[model samples]
Target: MLTDPTMWRPAGEMHRCLTDGGSAFTEIFGTPFFDHFARDAETAAVFHDGMAAMSEPENEPIAEAYDFPPTGTVVDVGGGHGGLLVEVLRRRPGLHGSSATRRTS
Candidate 1:
């Protein structure tokens, strides 16, 4: 099950440390590490590329498991980088879709 950060202190602390430290983390995991990814643009690019390396294979099973409503408009809210929505639209050719930062008044 997923845990909400507001309700869980350890999760929040872990996230903080991941974003904050090098020694406490690098000691356990060793070098060629994420400190650069957190700060450097080139490293971030390489990190994102590494993450994308597995995305297509990782997402194929998920794409097969679900169906999108095909005839009406579908809005994806805060959909991360639009990848999943793009995949859904690709799989469901008849659907009209839009992705928004948020639903607002």
Candidate 2:
């Protein structure tokens, strides 16, 4: 299993193999997973849809509990695609919206 990276290894065996090696499955898969999903349009869309559905309603309670000033520009830093910001704007229409992400070279 360790020698062959792509072979169909069972989950239990894979878990044991990685755990015994002191390397997490995430350690092996994280970079490639993010690289592929982040760059691929279809993958990114699927991921966003999943995340959006998860964010809604589950976040509403927390959103309702918080208080924001009636008017001001709220800059959401490193806000990925602005899902949370959209929710906040939807709840509080008076607040101005601004999102900033680190520019990728």
Candidate 3:
């Protein structure tokens, strides 16, 4: 998505987007990025895959740094693949957690 020419157009025309009351992506694609993403399963998968890959390194550190309460629910919003939550719950055995999103085959 970042490599797409249309994605770059938004950077160049950010002021126009700000004044026109639309996102930089909407100005270029005639729709919001999420709208486009929702319509294209392949793109959505790629985006999610990228996010999950990028999040891998961060999850370990986050899980290590935080101190979760012994008996409470931890919620991860947009927790694709549940990597972060899994690590967190793994470290804190008694702390239950829920991921907002689940991986799909």
Candidate 4:
């Protein structure tokens, strides 16, 4: 969707369009982005797999680039599955972290 022409429109216009109930995702896929995922389990799985594959390569680099305090808690809000937090905790022995997001039953 990043490469979609509609996504490249001016920010203000896009926001206005979205506010008016227009969706670039709906235009391309006949549903809003997340709705498309909800409607297609296979596609959602593939998309998540792709994201995990992409995140793995960056985790080590991200872990090394940052310096955490010797002992403190790091909260990764909305970080899916806590991959980065796990890496960070691995590298920083005394640091603690949590990946948290609200989930509906």
Total clashing pairs for each candidate = 0, 0, 0, 0
Worst 10 residues of 3 by lDDT: 1-10
Q: What would you estimate as the lDDT of candidate 3?
A: 0.79
| TM-score of candidate 2 relative to the true fold | 0.54
Clashes of 1: 0
Best-first order by TM-score: 3, 4, 2, 1
Residue 52's lDDT within candidate 3 is 87
TM-score of each: 0.44, 0.54, 0.76, 0.61
At residue 37, candidate 2 shows an lDDT of 51
lDDT (Cα, 0-100) at 2 in candidate 3: 56
Question: By TM-score, who's the top model here?
Answer: 3
Model 1 residue 12 CA deviation (Å) reads 16
How well does model 4 score by local distance difference test?
0.69
**lDDT over C-alpha atoms for residue 1 of model 2:** 20
lDDT ranking, high to low = 3, 4, 2, 1
Candidate 2: C-alpha lDDT: 0.60
Higher-lDDT candidate of 2 and 3 = 3
* lDDT for each candidate structure: 0.54, 0.60, 0.79, 0.69
- Expressed as tens digits, the lDDT of each residue in 83-103 for candidate 3 is 999999889998899877643
**Which of candidates 1 and 3 is the stronger one according to lDDT?**
3
TM-score of 4: 0.61
Better of 3 and 4 by TM-score: 3
Off by over 4 Å in 3: 1-12, 15-21, 101-105
The total number of steric clashes, by the backbone 3 Å criterion, in model 4 comes to 0
